[model samples]
Target: MELTILGTAAAEGWPALFCACDTCKRARAVGGKNLRSRAGVQFGKTHRVDLSPDTWYQEAHLGADMSALEYLFVSHSHDDHWQPHCLAYLRPPFAHANNTPVQVYGNEAVVRTGRAELGAEQTIAVFNEVAPLKPIPAGEMTVTPIVASHKVGEQCLNYLFASEGKNVLCAWDTGLYEDESSWKFVENVRLDCVILECTCGPSKCERYHMDYEHYLAFKERLEKAGSVSSECIFVATHFSHNVGILHDELEQYFSPHGVCVAYDGMKIVL
Candidate 1:
């Protein structure tokens, strides 16, 4: 599988729309990889993890031929992840390439949020809402949407994208799954790679998001339980500006633990 990190920042994005914080300033000055948009990931152009408001930028910057995206896996209906207003741009004359209808899978809320754009369009596109633990097929992958700990009245998901005997744990918009079932399920499943978020910092207030400390602890637990093999690639992403840490700084903390910190445009083929 070819994995591409389209954007790495949390909701507001790195160097947010109008914020003038020191980190934002530095990010602006150090363009390149430091410039992170809202969270999203693309797998071989045929599949994508989430859709952020910066979809256009992601498409352009990644040099992605949007036509390859036949399936869009939505994690939640959050503004940063599911910007329905932008879906119209992908309809009709806008997207003529592959012209394959994009099948979007998510929770009910995710469906309700994007369905409006799916209507009255001549473009080839369809939206499907999926519940947790239910397996569905999209292109070459079989996706199992798992429950997430992000919000109320919505389906925030952590997906297991499996194909060709390999699986990837795409965990974003999820807090540490405190539920016993969540951990029990994770303990038995083997993964080639795990993509999780580190939106929280080292600070103890990491209830809704995992901090570096929590992330490390999670990795240790995965390792200790022997659930993950030595070759499993654990990648940390979906960073928040409030974390107040740079990519290199975060790398130093994760690199030694066999965890890889993702940057925009970075690709890992597994």
Candidate 2:
């Protein structure tokens, strides 16, 4: 499976659209990887996790082709992650020679929110409500949704993608593993690639997101539980300007721990 890190910033994006903070200024000056978009990832042009508003920009600037996307797995209804407006382009004059209806998988809110956006007249896409621990077959992999502690009154999810002999954990927008069921499910599966978020950067956040410390703790806990493969690749992404850590700083902080810092357009083949 080929996984592409499409966007790596938190909801507000690094160097947020409307902020003149020192960190944002530094990000602007650094340019390159320091400048990030909202979070999302694509697997082999067919399976994608999250549908950020930056999808179009990623496609144009990063050379990502989503015209062949078949399955879209949404984490929650957050606009940064689930921008259903893009679905409009999937059909009509915007797209040509593509008749495959994109299958969307998410929780109840995801379904409702998407439906509300597309309305009753829309086609070219189908929404399937996904539940935690319920594995569903994709083209060549099985997607298992895991509960994530991000939003209250919403069934937020992290995903475990198992294909061939490799397992990938897409845990962006996730906090510490608090639910027993979530932990039990993760404990049994061996992860080869972990795409976890370090949204809070240097700050300490254990609720809706993770910080640099939380990233280490999460990795340590996974190691202690013996759930990671010997050659597992751990990546830290989903940055925020609030914490003042740019891409280089992130690399400096996480590199020693064998955790890679993801940048926009980064691709990993497993």
Candidate 3:
């Protein structure tokens, strides 16, 4: 399987859309990997995680193609991760040659948002409301939604993707798992890769999002659960400019701890 991290920044993006902070300034001047869009990922050419608002920019500049996407899994209804309007482009007058409907999986709010955006009669995509811990089959992979701790108003989710003897957990847009049951999935499934969020950077915000400290604790918990091995790849993404750590500095800090700092357009094959 081939996985491409389409973006690596938080909702505001690295350098932000409208900020003049020193971190943003440095990122703007440095360019290249220092610049990041809203967070999202694509698996091969058909499956994607989180439909960011920057999907168009990602496609135009980052060598990403949404034209052949067959499956989309949204973490929540957050604007940065779930831009429902993008589904509209899959229909006539906007898209071509791609006639197959994309299967979308998310919380109830996410399904409602997509349905409202596409209107009741639209058939370009099929929306599926997924529950936590229940596995859904997508092509050859089994995707299980794990409960996320970020949003209380909705049943936010993190995904565990299992396919071809590989188990990859995408755990972000959330803090540490609140309930012990949230860790139940890891008991039977070992992870080959983990992509987690370090949104608050150096601080420790364990309620809504993760900081570096929380990130470490989370990893340790996973290790204690025997969910990951020494060979498993651990990637940190969804950075905020408020963290004030640039790409190189982030590498300096995380690399020593055996964690990869994700940059926009980073690709990994498993």
Q: 1-270 in candidate 1: lDDT tens per residue?
A: 878888889898987778888888888888777788888888886888888888889888776546667888889888889887666766557655564667888888878767775676525557787867878977678988888777866657888888888888889887788656667666778888998888875555546678877787777777777778778999998888777767777788788878888888888788
TM-scores, each model vs. reference: 0.93, 0.97, 0.97
- Tens-digit lDDT string for candidate 2 (1-270): 788999999888888999999999999998998889998888987899999989889989997788888999999999889998788778768887374688999999989888888886357789899979999999898999999988989989999999988999999778897789998888889999999998998887859899888889889989999999879999998888887767888888888999999999999998
Task: TM-score winner between 1 and 2, please give it.
Answer: 2
Query: Which number leads on lDDT?
Result: 2
Query: Model 3, 164-233: lDDT tens per residue?
Result: 9998889889888885668777656789999999998886565988998988888888898888977999
On lDDT, the stronger of 1 and 2 is 2
Query: Which pairs clash inside model 1?
Result: 101-124
Clashes of 2: 0
| Per-model root-mean-square deviation over C-alphas | 1.7, 1.1, 1.1
- Backbone clashes for every candidate come to 1, 0, 0
